[model samples]
Target: MQVSREEILHIADLADLNIEEEKIDKYLLNLQDILNFANIVNKQDVSNLEITIGSNEAKNVFRKDEVKVFENTESLLENAPKKEQNMFKIPKVIN
Candidate 1:
């Protein structure tokens, strides 16, 4: 579509912009190109493509939680700086 210089200036004025006199022609041509590309995209045929809500159709993909006993409890707590009841004894955080 052809964009006029007056229309460009009017849009700029509405947007509270102060466009330079020399750049109006450049802006007019750029706006016209963008509108022409949009028209081309609007006229495309997409009847055979599947409609997607997002990039993929993945849902909740998590493994079931199960408790298991460790064989070597002494080795796991060997490097603990403080151990009281067969476990790593950390400083009490909450009052």
Candidate 2:
């Protein structure tokens, strides 16, 4: 699966990329290396390998949820630059 320079230029054109003249060879080599790797992987035999979804036996594992109350209020807001009504305040983000 040899990639030509013209095909690389065509791909750049389709992607709307401004590839410099000197960088064309670099792009061509990188693309060719990727295609070569893909071809190598495609030629491998994986018929004996088992199809497994996960490495662990656990499925949908979740911890118990509980509310925790902090006794320190002044210490929590001590480092905040802008604190309002016992909370960190920020400028309106959604326009």
Candidate 3:
């Protein structure tokens, strides 16, 4: 899992990153650590693991929709800046 300076520069170029000269060593160490961790993960055995397409406890919690007229219609229209025919009047948007 040894990452070279050339590989680091290539990765930086691919990611469009401008790594400072002093920070190149830091990037090289971090990239090598990531590669080492990936190698460790690739060595794991998961052949008997079940393939889950969906959750076991998943269920719809939606309530049934109901429509009812408001009791205080005049009070709702009182806060509107412009009212016309008991509806809020807004500026015309389309020409």
Best by lDDT: 2
Candidate 1's displacement at residue 76, Å, is 52
lDDT of 2 by residue, 45-83 (tens): 978987679888747978889888888888989889998
Per-residue lDDT of model 1, residues 1-95, tens digit only: 67888899999999999899999888888898889888975677977877777787757678879888999888888888999888778889999
Model 3 lDDT per residue over 1-95, tens place: 68899888888899999889999999888888888888975687877887666777666689769887799989999999999999999999898
- Error at 73, model 1, angstroms: 55
Ranking by lDDT: 2, 3, 1
What stretches of model 1 exceed 4 Å from their correct place? 44-95
What TM-score fits each model? 0.44, 0.44, 0.44
Model 3 earns a TM-score of: 0.44
lDDT of each: 0.86, 0.89, 0.87
